[model samples]
Target: MSRLAGRRSAVDIVIGVVTHVTHHELFHDAARTLSGVDLEWVSYDHEDEIRDKVAEFLSTTRLDGFLAGPVPYTASQELLPPGLPVGVIRSSALDLTLALYRAQERGWGRTPVSIDTFPAEAVEAVATALDLDQDQIDCLPYAPSQSVDEIVAFHRDAFARFGERSYVISVRAAVRGQLSGQIPIMSGMPVPATIRTELHELALRIESDRASAQRFAAGVFLISDAPDEERARIALMNHLHNTPEFAGAWIENRGRRGVVVFAHKALFERITRNWVAVPALAEAAAALGARISAGFGVGVSARNCVLLAEQAAARAELAVEPCAYLFEDSGVVIGPMGPVGAALRYSYRSHGDDVERLAKYVGLSATTVSRLAALDQELQGRTLSPGELAGHLGITDQSGRRLIRTLDAGGLVSVEGTAQHHPKGRPTRLYRLRIAQALEAQPWSSPAATSSS
Candidate 1:
């Protein structure tokens, strides 16, 4: 900061992490409060590239000073080329060292360490603030950064690993004086994402219980049966949002469809384990003929969060009686066979009834109608040969053909296509359920959707 002092200089700080914007903002405020040096920040999708670009600002450039906003883990070859005095400020080295100690203390030690730094302090701050010994404090050295190229790549890799979590492209501390800010950005990720796939797999292990959640995020679950369900949910939402333990949260009906409960993704594991759903919903389910279940998901972005919540909601059905199974993995994944599965089965059964309706129209026997329904259900709406239908219904294949032809004459079922078996033998006919008229009393609404399944 002293380097930028007293000179009419333009300082550019490029940063990678959105959460770290506040730290940079404070730095600028202090400059105005103290040195009065003007600094401009240009934000981008990834930080490593931004740092490399900032590093190049040194060549053939008449800039006053450069601050690497938490650059390449401090004091490395990436330290703004050492052509000018550059200070790369991280929030607190001592605090970080203590965090490392806490993690290591859990015996979670390993080589090539990584810190998310978001949840550590937010959780334990009030209970335990900056208490470390000299041996413990030494862990906070600027992490080794070999070159600007390697250092920037490291940060980008870290950001990439945080995939499917909520992230955005934003700019802050805009440059008032300029060289143009147009630069090509590259992100190799697929569009329309949810949680990082790896993270979701890990989340599977985390049951929605109390203690397990303490590891993921802060705050406790707010079950329904509170004086007012919506009011309680709103209060908890606001409360968690304000807390550092909050990454984000949602309100779910719990196992009870009618009631709402507030849950923090940070604490979902505990809640799941506890069989916690909104009690009000449980009460309402008894009143309604059908039951209700609910669950919630959490993380960095609203879209990913909704995906998570829906995943939880899907699982809640598994816990409840109607739908008793939920599967993990998003998009085109198979689900369990409880109530929702039963609902699907019932729909197919209802469609089979049209065979009876057609039987009445064609004046076929009760046995014939039952046989046709059985064959139709298995064929999945595809036309079946009378021989195949007869084989399916334990009748002689030729007899089945005669039966189908009689029905075809009445337009109950149709021989839509034919295939020649042998020039001498005969041509095989294909018959399927005719939809000339609507069947009565439909079941479970329309066709199954992959989204709900």
Candidate 2:
């Protein structure tokens, strides 16, 4: 929400758009015109500055989502807030076809020509669609690894092979700039339909967030047992009051051993998304030498939700860690939160044939398996310490160490080194997640369940 957010009479959502290239004004105008929903758009100029621009926008104004080019979207994924929605604009087939038509209109299609804009497959697809023969086209493919000089050389070679009066088709700014004056070049920009579709998806995500924000939930904690130390109790209360997750919460003491805390439903659901808070709370209680268990309930009203959460928390205390359980208004109980402990013997629903196979092979929950796959790509075969792993998983350090041990037991990680005290006394141990190797391993009919037992 910006200063101009609710000012628009018809617009229901506010979003930000970042255009890296100058021509993005066309996309911004087109998406704004074609999209049926009333939207207030904030424009940003640089793609490389996505993180700074987005953070500033988020702080100053409220937005449902952000739109950017594919390069900016991919580069900013890890930097942006994980919960925030981002949409990427890409060039469509129609755009490529139109550019080729422009070249044809210039009478360049009549002679054998060379084109260098997209990759080989894309070039081939466009050539086929335009009914241009392979013999008449020397399609120079663009590889991401190629340097600007390499691309320039490629275009120069194509120009030499096809002779004068031919044209070079390039989408890259560098390639086009270099080929200018030396050769005739045509630009291919993304079409409005493609941009509108991406924007529509962003609007849908904003709607989803709005819907989720409206759903009310509450957490009820019952500290069934605790040490008789008054200092410990006071410390726990102070820490709870200071926690951002429990901000604006109301906490009450029931005797010396029991307590009740209430917070917004949205806060609890946000924790659930990252699988972080419940485990962090467990670790916190352990550090404070207090025995605590909590439950969360989602409903239309706060009072009923608290009562349900109390009941769910009572049930959770029977477990070892006493991780929070979620109780829906419809009477559904979800979990002992955090990563599902390896000791639990609960049946899991398979995501699909492929996911089920991967989960089974890795001896982890479907969610964990999916995250591990994503981490594999992010790490690029490099190792990460427990602290780094915690940062990656959005969990506390203790919880991250526990997860690493669980992963180790599942044969999904290789310990690369022993813990060494840093010059500053901080400890470090190198460990690599062996997800790729796990995929290559023989499929086990029954992989060890995600537990030490």
Candidate 3:
């Protein structure tokens, strides 16, 4: 039964089924038939051809995801594209039971056996079901680099130990071929239910991808003028058009002001998948000599999204570097999208009145106070040295010390520790920002005013 059958306009999810042989091809066809999902089978004779075959399928077909049938899990992982979700059909308990039942017909049940398949866990599960221990069966689990000769040797050794009573169960057809005449080799292939389960998993992943793409997130990019600014705009448009995998048709040309719409999913996926992706994108842009300010926004409507994106763009423009900013729906503003954004969001909860009072008391701007609070959060509420405060404020140590004195006097910060300076100099005191406490203190009183009086 199709999970999507009752929908108003049901989309037939296109999937690529990759397998090695004709038998597995039939198995996958049955799987697709049972699944009630569209499947395109791409078979390769040799394991090495899996990469090329999968590439061909992706280029020709609109595949939602891939099902690696009878394909080694390790090989499938190596062959398929990094972005595509891959599900593998491997030996299950049913496979082991069915193979054993078949062997029982040939008077081989309860006999000592050797098996070669993917993962030892599968064999162990089957063994547990039959109330047998690991020592009773000789099992050689397949890894990516294991050779056919090694498999043959393992089977030969098992046969030597148990003689005629020894039976061989192999998942690989190649192993079956080599040991056909010598042992009662039964195929321990994945059951129909396992195949269906994997296909269902693939369907879920595709649905998730579609839903994520449909989510409304806006990006307003500030593309700095090139020598031929129009040419640069054209170049960017062409670049977007050429890469449908990333940009798709989800881009709008706003001329020299650049595109108001850049796909946030692309950037979001990149960031989620790789921690260094934000920095990586910046470095890539730098290498291309592209001075771009990208701001991402997500909201209910296009108007709100654009406004939020504009705010994000304004934030991005503050830094002298090329970066991306995200305007989240929760009113949390973050980014320069790399290292700066990594620590920028903490304490940016924006208590404007509170920040203003603290800034006045500390003889600092609201912006400086906000930055200090954010830094305090990054420091995990630890006391900060004057040098650290100076770096955060982009000021000299003397200026930082003077500001700290004002804040200390105003009760916005309290001295936590002191480090004695060399020889004759005064001690350097460390202070922790008490912005939350200052915020609660109600009316602002200027430490600068109090000192003068």
What does the lDDT read for residue 154 in candidate 3? 92
Each candidate's root-mean-square deviation in Å?
29.8, 16.1, 22.3
TM-score of each: 0.20, 0.53, 0.53
Identify the runs in model 3 with alpha carbons over 4 angstroms from their true place. 1-10, 25-29, 32-36, 48-52, 55-59, 70-79, 220-291, 297-321, 325-453
> Which is the leading candidate under lDDT?
3
State the displacement of the C-alpha of residue 129, model 2, in Å, after optimal TM-score superposition.
Answer: 3.3
Tell me the tens digit of each residue's lDDT in model 2 across 280-392. Answer: 45655766767767777777787787777777777778887657677766434556674333222121221122333445433234445656656776688888888889898
Model 1 score (lDDT): 0.35
Writing each residue's lDDT as its tens digit, candidate 1 over 282-340 gives 33334332344443434444455445545645554544353322122221111223322
> What's the lDDT for all of these models?
0.35, 0.59, 0.62
Query: 264-382 in candidate 3: lDDT tens per residue?
Result: 45455454232122443354355445676767776777777787888877777787766667665545454546533353332255533456444543334444566666666677768
Error of 1 at 342 (Å): 85
